[model samples]
Target: MAMEKTKETHPHTLGECTKSILPVRDALEVLSGKWKLPIIISLMFGNKRFSQIAKEVPGITDKMLSKELRELESNDLVKRTVYDSIPVVVEYSLTEYGHSLEIVIKTLRDWGVAHRKRMMVAE
Candidate 1:
């Protein structure tokens, strides 16, 4: 049976609610946790070495950074590159797909700034 498309005035179906939420849950899963967004923000400026990312996102341990980088790379959001040189060089950069988060990040930043000001005024 074809599911009826409800207008905004109509009550939503269980399937409608689940469909809406599932994608957001998946996005949050990929972007979740304390260090992931911070790492992404650091890489947004430019590519960096692992140590550089660790420095930029203060308080994240080397282990956590390494783990987070691996996850991001696995998700195809971050690219890891290696160079054949005197000493091996590894760099991390956001993939073009990752760069797609630019607007989302900016919107979050704006909301954060506004929320901070709102909270201050409320206090």
Candidate 2:
């Protein structure tokens, strides 16, 4: 049909592009924010307590950290573990699903380093 030919010839139309990029959109929906990636990066060192992550991330308020952690947990990117103790201890760590992001994180880090160098050279 003519419509089929048109679709094949113009594969990059808005609708087609949107479908092609839906995975990226979904990833961004989960990972696009000021704190999500940083929080994930912070946990890369190992499991950390709430206070520890806050200190490592720097400038994130308690409220913001709590909210972001909940989001990450809901997305299965982070796991929260609570221990029974006199005072009760809670720690956060990346889940197996979160560990799957290592490649993406490393790629971003490498690109960021190169970008910074490029900017410096431009200056």
Candidate 3:
């Protein structure tokens, strides 16, 4: 048995290291979860109730949905409103900051669809 070592071909330049790392760090902070994207996509159309959002996004447990929504709300990307009535209604909508993410999300979705199609054809 022989051991093989791989060499690092792409070395990071000072500018490349800074520019490449910052966006990824920021993106991870904002979009770091299984349910984050789905939650954002659900709220894209408009405000939605907790139940409505959960229903619209399939396969998410009630607890997980609640948690992700709270996280987004805390990050200022999502707004939470509660209407005081006989039955309290809590609605979730995107803040201006969240709305700004629409383009990014759409781009990612488009890329994913194209990638999937290419993979299918290759198979």
Candidate 4:
């Protein structure tokens, strides 16, 4: 299936475009998970082993990490590579489609920092 281009430079932001798609339903479907975004963000840096990803993202259990990785792979957002050697190794990396989310993640992070500062100043 052809991936839809969600990015627009016009009057509306991607969130707005997403809203126009299905509003509550589609948004929830895309963002529904505790660890999806975190996992995606972690893989943005580059390919990483399962253990490395677990270390980079705190508070995620091995089972949950594996599950999340599988889901991401199924969604085509992440690619899994296996290496053959004395000790086999596997790594996960974001696909080109996943790289498109980098800007959105960075924007969200920036907004979060600004929001926290504002809240702290208000207190």
**Weakest 10 consecutive residues of candidate 4 by summed lDDT:** 23-32
Give candidate 4's TM-score: 0.76
Going through the candidates in the order shown, the clash numbers are: 0, 0, 0, 0
Best-fitting candidate, measured by TM-score? 2
Write out the backbone clash pairs for model 3: none
State the lDDT of candidate 2 residue by residue for 38-115, as single tens digits: 999999989999999999997999999999999999999999999999799999999999999999999999999999
lDDT of predicted model 4: 0.85
CA lDDT scores, all candidates in order: 0.92, 0.94, 0.90, 0.85
Q: Return the lDDT, model 3, position 84.
A: 98
Question: Ranking under TM-score, best-scoring first?
Answer: 2, 3, 1, 4
lDDT of 3 by residue, 47-74 (tens): 9999999899989999999899889989
Candidate 1: segments with Cα more than 4 A from true spot: 1-12
Clashing pairs in 4: none
Model 3 C-alpha RMSD vs. true structure (Å) is 5.5
**TM-score, model 3 to reference:** 0.84
Could you tell me how far off, in angstroms, the CA of residue 21 lies in candidate 2 after the best superposition? 1.7
lDDT of 4 by residue, 3-112 (tens): 87865766656467556667657545664688888988888877899999999898999999999888888888899999996599998999998888788789888999
The estimated TM-scores of all candidates read 0.83, 0.85, 0.84, 0.76
- Cα misplacement distance, residue 123 of candidate 2 (Å): 2.8
